[model samples]
Target: MRPAFVAALALCLAALPAQAQQRFKSSAGDLVVETVAEGLQNPWGLAFLPDGRMLVTERAGRLRLVSSDGKLSAAIANTPNVTGRGQGGLLDVALDPDFAGNRLIYLSFAEPRAGGNGTSVARGKLNQADTALEQVAVIFRQMPTINSNMHFGSRLVFDRTGALFVTTGDRYGQRDEAQNPANHIGKVIRIRPDGSVPADNPNKPGWQPEIWSIGHRNVQGAALHPQSGQLWTAEHGARGGDEINTPKAGLNYGWPVITYGVDYSGLKIGEGTAKAGMEQPLFYWDPSIAPSGAAFYTGERWPGWKNSLFVGGLAGQMLVRLSTQGEAVTGEERLLDGLGERIRDVRQGPDGYLYLLSDDAKGRVLRVRPAP
Candidate 1:
């Protein structure tokens, strides 16, 4: 309240790093964004343990834990071998539904194979000492590996029925294969936790038994609707037409065949925008947000944001909030407007806060909470 005290406080605050000093406002309300930790190399995905610590993955094939006090642990050892080049690397991480008891975690990574590499999902039990993964096993692999380094659409989501859904990309050079369900180039794959094909999957003749849906370009974000229990996904578009789709059973999404986006060369793409057999998007962004990670906020810490979906904007370098009712997205707002950082993943922490991973050579773990 005094002038001298105010000057001293300003000097003290200015001495702190930007991570602790930055704040922003959103439609929900004003927010305080603080750095939980730093020194992450292109961090891609994050999952929280029940004990309030975090499991975060770096793109260079290491998994690390961030304590509640913002201390980052040494990289957990014994992770599977990843290609770790281009868009290929350790991507997304998720805990098993019963992780408290099973201690099992799943990882999606760019896997090296005979021909080249593809997205692969593996499950392993975390040791009690927090040092390494034990008994790791590959559960699913995108069919037909390719040499290209882009479009490894690798997000892991577990549905209400406990089936794990893995998103596979068109492998850059294979965009046309998205329409073909016989091989798993660009598709949402459904499999049991143990890698078995579900009997309920559409087992049509000539279709892969694990195929849940077909015709996707490069889906990097996927999450379950808190109320409807449906899987929602956000994918990258070439130049425009980034989409938010709720992929359904055995449906076609019409990626390369029909899209609102044009090719990188500014030429028309696909067979116009619609076709008879393909399903439409719930929402889409033109001029492209290049959405990467997604989550539906069900927390009470922030007003006007309950049940709203939060998506990370990679190319846009911000966060997008979508107001929702049940499964339909009704409105959209952009947050962290001038914060020039590539948001790679978004998650709702157990403490009713939102957490984000900034994708960079020197990435950071950022926590967003209500401002006082």
Candidate 2:
């Protein structure tokens, strides 16, 4: 071959890997992962609209619409401002249960304050024809903004009764705040669709009325159990001891006071992982998988995966599946090990397939289906 011909052949071969589909075998069946959309910047959240389109959030405070066939629209207009510093940025997106009539949507983001930034929840009406949000309002803001940008735990989930559940972090330097219900930091709050405190919330004395549960470190993932309707969450640990807990009203989850993890410097954490009056994790991982977004697999695409809980792993770069028997996690499986991309968020699409958003500057939204 001539030199020019040989060079062209080499370039073509090098580009093949980038466009190839990723395949994996799991308990469900032979799986094929295809890139549905690309060019997203650190995509953080995924929500499907009633019309089968997808609403995605990028960590740098942009929202984009993805068509059913994988085409990505330009960033939607009038998104809330976000800090985008450290672990803070645009976080989660959730649609109203009655979105067909209301066209309402909710977003979680790191709002910039005077001294620092804190997690805030906002909702607006999505105007599809114009591709902009209308009447956007900040409904809830975490209290006591701190200087550090790590651990802005934010995930939005609506319970069976249509109330909203918002998870929060301990704000990095303030682990002790997890045990304090007086503030929104390190707590899971339950509120009405219009951001009002529910009258039935466990209103302990001196605690914020919005607080539903306390003592969380950095709860990055939350889902409503498909069968039992309980709220399950996944939180980060220091060196080891990532946890999955079923948070209940007025319960403490024992973050700084009792942890299975140690300090980043290898020193032991408080109380050695067990303490009285604090709830134990339903499941936990040692050495830390850095779990993020989560969802319950009630879809029919994978016959064997019904009722399974799926969690995205950032540091592990895999999808974590937990087999649950009622309230207990019976088994665990890690998928997409070979692709080696950080899974930022996972959701079950209306078509009954699993959708994943990769966390990267040049991120892609992937769809998982059984191979034909």
lDDT of each: 0.89, 0.88
Give one clash count per candidate, in the order shown.
0, 0
Q: Worst ten-residue run, lDDT, model 1?
A: 9-18
Q: After superposing candidate 2 on the true structure, give the runs of residues whose Cα lies further than 4 Å from its correct spot.
A: 1-19, 128-130
Q: Assess candidate 2 and give its lDDT.
A: 0.88
TM-score of 1: 0.94
Quote the lDDT for 327 in model 1.
Answer: 72
Candidate 2: how many backbone clashes?
0
> What's the distance in Å from true for residue 96, model 1?
0.6
Checking candidate 2 for backbone clashes, the offending pairs are none
Q: Summarize candidate 2's per-residue lDDT along 268-343 as a digit string, tens digits.
A: 8888778899999999988899999999999667878898999999999999999999889999998988877899
Q: Per-residue lDDT tens digits of candidate 1, residues 1-372? A: 465754554353223243654678887678788888899999999998876678999999999998756778999999999999998899999999999899999999999988799999999999999999999999998989798789999899999888999999999889999999899988999999999998899877778999999999999999999989999999998899899999998899998999989999999998988999898888999999999999999877875788888999999999999998877889999999878889999999766778899999999988787787
